[model samples]
Target: MFASITGADKELLSCITRLPSFFWEGNWAEEIHLTICPIPSLQDGNDLTVTRDNTGCRIEYRLPVHLFRGLGLLKEHAEEKNFFINQKMYIPEIGIMTDVSRNSVPSPEFLQSLLDRMALMGLNCLILYMEDVYEIEGEPRFGYMRGGYTREQLRSIDDYAAGYGIRIVASIQVLGHMEKVLRFPEYAGLRDSSSCLLAGSEETEQFICKMLSSIGSCLRSRQIIVGMDETHGLGEGRYRVLNGRRPPIEIYLEHLNRVHALAGRYGLNIAFYSDMLFKYGSEKHTYLDPHMQLDEKTKELIPSDAQLIYWDYYSREASLLNDMLACHRSIGPTVYAGPLLSVSSFCVQYEATWKTAGPALMAVKRQKIPMVYGCLWHDDGAECSDWLGLPGMQYYAEHAYTEGVVDPGSLDSRFLACTGLDAGWFRDAALLDEIPCINPENRWPPNPCKYILWQDPLEGLYDADIRGLSLDLHYRRTAQLLRRDLEEAGENGAFLRVPLALAEVLEIKSALSGALSWHYREHDMTALQQDAAALSELYVRVKKLRRLHREQWMSSCSPFGWSRLDLRYGGLLARLETASDRLQDYLEGRLSELPELAVPRYTLDRCGDLLGNGIWKVYDKSVSLSDG
Candidate 1:
């Protein structure tokens, strides 16, 4: 539809021209005039005032994001000639941390799209969580064969983020979670323990210096999130051999000081995940432990400048979150990092995300925390897209804009205000993992889709846990719903197709083990042959899912880490064909029995600790226990 837009500068006009593709639906019968007055503000994020007058629609906004929000409001309320919208974003600093360190490094465009959406939502910042996912000069192996961004690439992304008044924060590993880079023979000396660098080592210090230099030069942001969160065996490895078992607290605090010195040299404010401090203090070494306490000495030693982020994505209770927030505050200036619940799964954990985010955000508001971020981590090889986390981010905004209880009605309307589509669209897409779950919320963050899809049809690692669940029907219906949504969703909602494809694959994949084991145990030859025939179709579906996954990955990411998922898809494809052939052989009487199914199945969940580190291991090993 033709519309005359005024009061928009070149950049505003550019974003407005792109708006139709992003959020526009049915064309207007007549031309619509939109006048945007985007003003600069000293505020952390933008606030907007949208009004409809007899002449046309006008938006008075402090930043590009607020203009976008104003545009969305104006467009949504096109019918209302007389209206006024004075929207307030409560949290001083609202941002999203995307885990690009995983297999996918999202394209600048992908990030820009997110920036556009965040702009509409009045969200202010973007954190690039790169554990060696950005190139460091003099260190080629750092993020080697991973989708690491070049300096120019990062600058482009940061520039686009700036247009929307979004401040981008750099999240790089200063001490731990450098296994990807550390695994290279060149960096072996820097390694102390699993995924951690040698504490107090001059060599490690020099390497970290390079990291600080790289981010400082590459991105415009002065804020850096130094990752030293889960250095579980910090002093137990090479550090012990060198330092002779100094107290972990002393070692950790010293490392923080060293990192602080490096960060200051680069003119950057530093932050680290506070889980380690709490873990070290708690007897059980658990994060979010209410009893977790840091001694005064340790607290005093912690750098006054270091912004400690209390990261939690698991807790569901307000009391627990409040207690934990209070505990962290006692230590130092704290930032709360909650989640979209995308960690360690093929799909978004909607139920768990909502349950945790709702209480966690409420607690942050209650505590009047200034800075909060919704972290979208790509665990288990970046199986899901970062695009899927939009709903959860909007949920954070909901909590931010509300002074009293977040209105239930405003949930959909406010979410729709950010993006034209209903919030239910993203929530529905996340149901790919919610089927096999027994509880109302998928609390343990069960990724039945990942484990079940990759688990052997006969071996069935989690078969005991899902023995009686009708996952086939659940996935089938879920697939149907997604397919419907995919058809209806225009270009703006094209991401729905990925989850739809995933659900379609899961419909058949989730049921294969149940069918295989049951048929083999019952000695049903005819049923086994039918299963063999189905594998042929499943194989085709698997190939399509992989292709779709690859296309989605490539469109938004650098091509480096794709080979990792490529190998996985290759393995999955090969196994599907092998599974069919093996079933055919068994049905033709070439094999005596299915030995894989014969192995006694054990329940994983009943073990009580299955949700611990095992959760990470299970997602990795469910495909195969060992490399062939």
Candidate 2:
């Protein structure tokens, strides 16, 4: 089919010649459409139908109801296309698909804010993972939703996103992660608590059908994301009460089939994670049965009509994505490739943020799957984060939409200049001849979390500058310690209302002042230092501030009329704020008086000049390396 098209038509055909040679024949290139036709029947006489009516265009296929039963073959079909295109020229449409899950319940305001940011970045789709986020109190016992938002609120978000030309796909965690439902007693029978198809009970099957039917009613999108990601721990803990004899996958497949069947009934296209089907799959870690390989038995069970969404977040290797794409292609023509952008719970350095997945994003773009989604893995639900990342997110979206390179220097400076002092300190690190900061403030970035940390020392150095960088290390260390203590104190009341917390706070402050004093002493040689007394005075004030906090420490808010947790947290934050202010004053004073040191544009030198000067050669490597 591909061979029939010559010149311009062949140009489109040439982009995918590297695909699997399994389907190649004398007339291979003549077939323009690489659509897969299984050896078996198409079921119910369904046809690959097409039409180009005046009101735009449409291609419709009357697929078999049992199309979802052959997930293995479907996967193979998807992979072959990828191999065919590896050696060719292709337009990469790297898309990110994610729905705001209820785990981090986002309101319309938040959703609109998120969508606005996404649109600015040139994203193509946003999936509303609304199932778990909103659960009614009782009745529908099998599944549960957690947030307090109304249906109107969610639809508003959907409409707003749609208006921006971003497709809003709906996602529902069908088979597992139903702990919310199991937590309540009424829905007990619906659970495969002991394994074997709810073991000893036939009612579970019918109940699941009813549950899916209900879920299907609310989701109007033509596409639905079936979150079959993590189901191993299913029926293991207290669930041993039901699914004991039935292995996790056995029950999962049953639940999957039912969902797919229901999807057909509701006139929706289905998609699910491919992790659970095969043993050596892209996300094999989430699978429980090592033997649940994509053998014939499992393959025959999956419906061909169902599309698999393969998610790969680990960027250390590309083999996983290659394997997943190959596997999905072997089965069918449609597949969804998604890469995670950021997970807020982890304190990964800003440099290694979502932009870290650039390689994977590039790979997905080249593949041009039917659907693409980016993930904001915000487990903690941080409503607002550092805006320095805004530019990076937008840049990645832009590149995904239009493949091109953007100047990092311009974006970096713009982001840093707009950010506050809290962001400026790290922004300066990029200029210090250590870590090369590409987007200091994260403005106009291709990927919001684009950054790299190298192991080798950066070149270009001077003796006087190296000495000052040494003192910066001491200041940075003290600041980090102070920040950690303050954070710990804020999280747990028991930690903050103790004498030890107060002691540690004061101790760190004193150490900071002593180090600042020594740094100022160096100015005598070159007249580079400002008044060191300001730093010492600031530290003294911080020490006194900690003393006041300790004196007023209390377990509950009885005196303040707020909750104990809130009251204690407020007090801890207040103390930390005061300390942070004083430290900032000292650093600002030093930076204003000191000439900005030239550093690597994209590396991190935590040890400052201390290591460059060979001082860290005798000190602990862990401490110094971490600083660097």
Candidate 3:
């Protein structure tokens, strides 16, 4: 049966047999007839058919050459079911955005791994959200020391992804989120605000042109996401100082027109975040709310060729999705709905992500939107691993292609078959946020792992808020459970070391903090000595955890961003050692007092703006304990 297969069909079968699940089952040895045909524009051109007989099965895959991998997965799934079925995607473009702008840049090999995984899941597009993570000519300080991708590296990645039938699109910041670019002296004079570029400035336009030209030279895809989202102070910085105060809407539209034309010069189709248009139009300044109203003039200003992406990761309401889609339709014909993969926070919020994106995708289906993409944004220091977002990506892909055909109960099996990981483990790993002692309401944006690990040792700013639970015992039990789970994971347990190490560190810190609190209350020197000894031991463990973290980070990402974790854990270790030395000296009557440890119990609400800002501020050298 397999003798007649040749060309692309043989290639597809080879790809299928390479899957971990396929290899484990030894199914690749079975006799099968697979024929591949390329059709002209078969509605996104990714479809599969499987027919069975007494001897073996014959699979007919009709798709473009680039999408052969998607056809392979379909054939594998069909072969498992032992029945013939037709599969076609409703959403033509199933895209993913990997944000490299938020500090963590994935290495080229790891990016190839991601592309291979995306191909297995039948995804067609990959967006690298490179705000300033790519080299630009004539801009020496642009992406300086940030480990941005070089032109050759990007070209290699683009070619590698194309082999898997995935289009590598560039997501660049053309307007706002340019703080990294603005920090340099060369670009400082072109700041519209601290974070946004100076709109309507010739210098800014030239900068954007150079950036887009460099991106076009590297990436293969014609689609570009010109990011203009969350430009809160647009036209309020130097633009206001130069050209008298102008309406922000006018400034934004002028900039949009300019950038859109610039992108067109590169033969690229432009897409932008739809937040600012709705933000400046309505008094409420929201995108998902049904009450969001866009003025006719503002809507009319939108370019006919521009694609508006309505991204909402916080809303679980289907009605709001419909409303947002409706508003977007009024702006342009090409509107893409975006859902969040919930990896922006320290730990992936699986439940929240599913709840919000599931309904959002359902609404997009109801509205018959042509395209939808899931965004995995790494906001504020990409603490969460990219692999953690895989389940969410699979969820969207399944919904896009086989929502009604596939049973909800078998979703896990399909997911397991597609990606060689248990769905249960993914969900359980997200339970790091659901630890009982944490306040559910306070964990908005949900990054309990980072928050707990970074909480100041002496101040106990976040840990002190625990109401009625023993931090030491709770974290100890959690660590034990995670250790058992890691053991059961076998080969896949390497990534599990990150959360496991974090839990162990949290347990040790909790115990140390509790001991310190007791010593402070009772003025016990014996207890201080014991705690100091434990601190020394825990510091060693912290070093071990750092090693584990380094291994994990390098496995999937570049070494550039691991320094952030280094700074965090390194600071923790130094503080622990210092405190231990001071405690020992005090017990030996060498020191008078430990002023930093002489703090009273206090709970702080709204510690700082971002998630770890408060605790990080407490540890900053400039800020004294008394000031905090």
Candidate 4:
């Protein structure tokens, strides 16, 4: 009963201390709970009431103000306060939730492993974007089956996360983003073609509402993010098929209203992206005025109680963040600001975006905004896992929420060393090995160390079948060269160049392997053998180059080493275990008497055995929640 505490909002809980308390509480083993979102303000909190029934914490909170309570603040005093709070001290609770859109949902053991790793890195939440993964009517999961999370399975995640003090935020796509559903046969008739929405009739509204109410009621979290971003298809004649005519926003507003109304019924505070209001330009979308000047129309459309998440990750400009703080202050004190935490750009360029974001976060903090969330907008979750996985994300998460600042390279090295991955990269290309290979596009220039370096490989072999070789070669080669150049780079030192170069190499390798696999079947042993042989030869050369030019490589890529292979390997291992069961079917003569002769039964069996045994050896190497 976290919401029962009155005046809890004013408590001014330090980000530092709260993390310790969170971990201590989680360790009790009796009750497991994790904070997913920002702690906002601790003051003015409703008194929370929880019984010792051995279940997790139950929470409820009242909306402090009505829709227009802060309307006055929007006009007169919008620009005075900053948008970010305690920028220096804010260590954000980051997460890596598997977006099961294109693939099947991970098993409970897989999730447990994931949660365990998240906890180690101080990640406090796991938000499963359900719509893209699960099957549902009207909201067909594109490129995959449209299924749903079982109640028991959902509860397992909830309970597991609670033990590590991590909250699971249920992300459901609603309103205009329902393209997947609209395109499905069963839901096609319900869509408003002219308006490109599902709100032309009562049936559609009921259908949408049922999802929110059902998921909200069952998720067990106080917050639910109703995804309403990228509604570009709205009002493009999709709605004209149903209604005579209607603007996209009108349909959106109607759906939003319905969803908002239902969210209140189940005691959940709803969060939505603030893109639609700003999509029509600063003038057309007055709610977007960097100065917080809201036009009449904007005021009319925006709900007074709805929590707006202003997502700005790329732009270093603070005007937008500043304007939000000002306008929200004039309106009332309910506005919340969260900057998207982007690690790819920073990792490749070695140019800290936070340097630009830091001041903005400070602005939000100064404005008395309750909390800030760091968004990891991974387009393809599996691919992006390597780009900004747990270690990399955790580094940024720590810096985002805390006052301490760390170099990306240092953090990478630290994580590698701490996780015992730094040493493991040489033996095997671990996820840590991918850290140096990140080829983040460098938007900043003039300073090479400020960015990663990508050069034409002097020599190398390419392989598509063997997974880690490309990344391994990329790091080994890039580290060799960058280490040499750092000596003359001066002031920027190794800091600027090493990370960028490493990132670029990683990107290149990942793309190359993905390309080869996509085009050729991995089971083609002849092709795989050719690629592997070439890669092996290249790997040897790169190793030789490093040894020969050890000083140069070390100097340039000063912070290098290790593999956190165990991180993602856990999931892979889980798959192998399942595969082994299938193999047992063959061994026990339970099904297929013969293994696919075309497929190497020996190789497949060996691969499966290796992975199954590997997972067992590193079973304890998972993380669940951030200290905060």
Q: Pick the candidate with the highest TM-score.
A: 1
Question: Mind giving the per-residue lDDT tens digits that candidate 4 earns over 377-397?
Answer: 423112122223344444544
lDDT of 3: 0.70
For candidate 3, report its TM-score: 0.88
Can you rank all candidates by TM-score, best first?
1, 3, 4, 2
What shift in Å separates residue 244 of candidate 4 from its native position after superposition?
3.6
TM-score of candidate 4 on Cα atoms, chains taken together: 0.52
TM-score of each: 0.92, 0.51, 0.88, 0.52
**Which regions in candidate 2 have their CA more than 4 angstroms from the true location?**
1-103, 135-146, 192-220, 235-244, 280-293, 332-341, 344-350, 380-389, 403-628
Ordered by lDDT, highest first, the candidates read 1, 3, 4, 2
Reference-based lDDT, each prediction: 0.77, 0.40, 0.70, 0.43
How close is each model in CA RMSD to the real structure?
3.2, 17.7, 4.1, 17.4
Q: What is candidate 4's CA lDDT for residue 140?
A: 38
lDDT of 1 at 416: 68
**Model 3 pairs in collision:** none
Q: Which 10 residues in a row give candidate 4 its minimum summed lDDT?
A: 66-75
TM-score of 1: 0.92
